[model samples]
Target: MTFDPTPPHEPRRPPPRSALGPRQLVGAILVLLPVVLLLGGLSRCSFAPGGPEIDPSAGPAVDAPALLRDAARLAPFAVRIPAVPPGWRSNAVDRATVAGGPGTAVRAGYVTGAGRYLELVQSDAPEEALVRDVAGTVPPPTGVVDVGGTRWVVYGGDEALWVADVAGVRLLVTGSAGEDEFRTLAEATLAGETLPAGTPPPR
Candidate 1:
């Protein structure tokens, strides 16, 4: 037998390290960098300080009597002796009265930084007592201006009292109604009264 001398075979080369090119690497970095930054920003925002921390009991205690006195001072006409109810806080006062005449009134008084009054009335008086009352609670009317196309007596106080007519419902008690509520009550009152055309509803 003839023994053939043969050279040893060479080993196969390994595959290329990766198919990613420089452009692909740059594109990936550009896309992923923004994602990483976004994640970091979201994490920082979640852990950031100075976020809203509310304590249900942290605010100043409400004083109803004090609110009533402030309301009296702010009201245009004298505040009839207010009969504050028990547990009333001096920082907030609301009163209601039904006179036997052509008027029914609802009043809300509050002192947030300063005094604020909101009143509703149905009467033929030149100025609605409720409007006067709220204006009185405010600093004082600088001048009359139109709000939402309706003319109102404006004032400067911590907050201003707003009055508008509500369209139905005969008697409404104060404290039970809000600013919009009083407006609704005033509108209702006007509809019931059926005043002459172009006559402004009682404030």
Candidate 2:
């Protein structure tokens, strides 16, 4: 047998080494990370905290005339006593009768004052009815105040006068419109006419 052996096959050349080493991979990642972060920051800057940009001033403008009309609608009905000062406006008068009474009592009034708006409500419900109604609706009086020697119970939002020891007269000065505006309206209304003694309160 001819035992001539062909030269051993040359060792297979090792696969070509990768050009990227671990350090090169890390460097490439570090370079790209800042670019990614910059893009993210720019995207965030274009929008608000949660989402789309919103123009703060883009809202409905207030309509003063419309507000005044609404206020007129909510205003209590009242007769503008002839004594109401010039420039004062009043709504039509309405009457409410007490559950039981001798003669019908009249109730009417308007807003007054400068700083805070005051709702002036006047009613002739007879002292008993006035006190009863007030007690029914509001907290008890803080204390009684004597005006002109007449004992008048003063609730937070109302006042009562005892007429003929049985009949009631009430002047409700409400801080309802709130303290600031109430002061303005109160002063204005108070400046107007005093309610007639027998004006009936509306039911």
* TM-score for all models, in order of appearance: 0.24, 0.33
User: Which digits, one per residue and each the tens of the lDDT, describe model 2 over residues 93-186?
Assistant: 4345555543233333333222112234445545555545534554555656443344445555343222222123344444334443333343
Candidate number with greatest lDDT: 2
The best candidate by TM-score is 2
Candidate 1 lDDT by residue in tens digits, 14-105: 65749767887798889899899999988765331322222323444555434434444433333322233333223333544433334334
TM-score of 2: 0.33
Q: Please report the TM-score between candidate 1 and the true structure.
A: 0.24
Report lDDT per candidate: 0.38, 0.41
Which regions in candidate 2 have their CA more than 4 angstroms from the true location? 1-87, 100-103, 113-123, 131-138, 144-152, 157-172, 175-203
List the candidate 1 regions with Cα displacement exceeding 4 Å: 1-95, 98-102, 106-128, 131-139, 163-203
lDDT, residue 145, candidate 2: 47
